[model samples]
Every structure is written in structure tokens, then in C-alpha cells.
Target: MRTSPFGRTALSFGFFLLPLFCRGSHSARNQTANVTLDASFVVVEEYAFGIQGVWVQHREPTNCTQSPEKPRTRDITPAQCNRTCFPGSFQPPRLSDCNKIIESLLNNNTGSLQANPHTWVYVYYESCVAVFENPDEDSPTLQYNWAVLGANVKSLVNSCLSTPDQNSIGGACVFDEYDGKQLSNVEVAVQRFTDFDDDHDDDE
Candidate 1:
């Protein structure tokens, strides 16, 4: 999704235009990415929910060249990455920050897993996100947002919502447990998609 020069220039002028996540209940409208502008800068409604993030891909690597007398390496240096986002796709914010954060999360023993295009990254600051009915207190309703620069991250999102996947991945990562871990397997994912409502928060 390459942004037109006009779009980039416009979004850049208002890059900090963050959106708001709904308070009190589960408003999928809270899942919207709204943008306008104040007299001086662009304005965007930020949501810990929509902007919370998932992954660039979910497919596993199909091949790995073996190392002589050693276990094959899991190094995921972007230069050596086998898969990539569609040409011209522009992840929001900065792709550099996403790479750094995702790379940090992919280090052996820590971080989430990345099987080629199926790269996984974690939510930052998250003072802006939420889980269930609770919103982060530090970041208010909006602040920072994390973006993945690739394909469908629905399964990854579900992993984050699920129990053991994220826990198994980053149970000891840090104090920010939920954001750091994967959101798959969550019991409350809306398979029967419908209008957002207060009751939705407790569907799980």
C-alpha cells in the first residue's frame, strides 16, 4: 500500500496524529483509525485495540541450509530474510523502528518467533492499548502505536489472545506481559463478526 506522495506528505505533516481506543466497553469503532487535524498538526484517534498489532506473516520457513557440524542457525537478519511484504506496501510510522523491535523480539531464547514472512513483533509502550475491558492507565486512551509491515496477522492476533502461545513465548520477557507475548488462541476472538458492543469485551 504505497502511499501517494501527497498522502505521505500529508501524513508526515501529521504523523503524530494518534487515535483513541474506546473507554468502558468494547467498541469496534474503537478499532477504527480516524484522522483529522488540530490547527497546528494532524489528529488521529489511536486505539490500543486496532493499533495493538499482530504480525507480518504466519507461515513457517520451508527450508534452511545446514551449517557444517553445527545446528542450523535461526538468524533472521533482514538482509538474509527469505520472505517479504508486497512491493510498495508501506507500514505505518517507520519500518526501521519495526525492524529493530521485531529483530529484538526474534533473538534466540527470547522474543517471538519469525518464520520468514511470518515475522512477529510486540506492542510498544502500550500505555495506549487494552485487553478485555481494561485500558492502559499510563498512556491514556492514545499515545504510541506499533505497526507490522506485511500480510494478514489474524492468527498471530489470535495467538496473542490465546493462553499458552504468548505465555510460552514470552512468559518471562518483562513486566509488560500481555503486549510482549503473542495474542493467538484467545478464547474471545470474534469468529462470528458482528457489530461491536459492551458485551463483546466479555465474550471470552
Candidate 2:
């Protein structure tokens, strides 16, 4: 894996300062690109369970590369990630009305609550929609269930109800736990690759 210039610094100090920076930005509705998808995901995840700070990450196709080997891991604010490869749009509700929006989005799918077609990058949500949209695929692992959305909503609500004070919602609390878990795993893998490359250069 290839590491961007921001990776090492991020590994050094990003996690510790995350909450502070996140708190500074109440909403990403108008912010250009100072927040990253990963960080914004954290902010939105927190907001879902009634925590504050909602940040969104918007990226153009050119901001990210499709290749897995040359992954872009940056420590800078989302605005500075000119060459970062991870791309997506993440919109979270404001802190004041997060609960209301969450409730509506999860419980009342009155066509008004449809996921953003252009921004719905999370695979689990897409897969659930796909199972409904394309019955001909005959996906063995994912059966077509009309109650899929309800089930996910129930699970997320239960998680929030169980632990409202937990600063970070664990894996089970997310719309799709796998998305966070997979992203985390990829970050770790990228870090290890960076370490290996550094060691190799030192030896040479």
C-alpha cells in the first residue's frame, strides 16, 4: 500500500484531536471540504445517538484514485486532501434536530426519506436496495426482505438506547457495522504497509 504524506502525522496525533476539531464544526451543510469522510462518518455516527457535531465530506472524482495499491491517506483537513483517493458525500443532520431526522429517516420512508442516490456509497445500504431493485440477481447471501430497512432501524435504535453515553458508538450501532469495520481494517493495513516501507528505506 502507498501512503500519502499526511498518514504518518495522522497516526501520530489525529485520533487524539478528533473530537476537538469535530466539535468546532457544528454542521457540514456549507463547509467546503475541511472534514474527511472518515472523520465525518465519526461525527455523523455520534450525532445519530444524540451527540453533537455534524460534518460532511464532499469529494470530486479526481480527488480520489480507484487503485487500491496507491491508497491516499491524509492527515490534513478534508479540504487539503487534494490527492486523497477516498471519495463520497456524507450528510448528517444538525445537532439540534438530529434525533428528529434520524427518526424520520429510519422509521418513515415516505419516499421523502430516500437515501441520496449520488451519495449512497455505503455498500450495505446499496445491497439492501439492490436486493429489492434486482430480484433477478438471485443473491445467495442476501435474500429479498421487505423488512430489511425496518430491521436495520430497529437494530440501530436498540444500540443507541442501550448505550447513550458511550462517546463512540460501537460497531453494532451503525447503519452498517461492516462499513466502519472495513474502513478501519483498511487504515490499519495501510499503516502497516507504511511502517514496512519506512523500515526498508532505513535498512537501505
Q: Model 1 residue 51 lDDT?
A: 21
**Candidate 1 lDDT, tens digit per residue, 1-204?**
311111223233422212221212222232332211122221111223222242121111112222335322222212111111111222122223223333323332232232211111123321111111111121111111122211112222233323422321111111122334322211111111111122313322
The 0-to-1 C-alpha lDDT of every candidate, in the order given, reads 0.21, 0.21
- Per-residue lDDT of 72-138 in model 2, one digit per residue for the tens? 2222111110111111122111122223323433443332211111111111110010101101111
**Runs of candidate 2 exceeding 4 Å displacement:** 1-61, 64-98, 107-151, 164-204
Give the TM-score of each candidate. 0.18, 0.25
TM-score of 1: 0.18
Span of 10 residues, lowest total lDDT, candidate 1 = 126-135
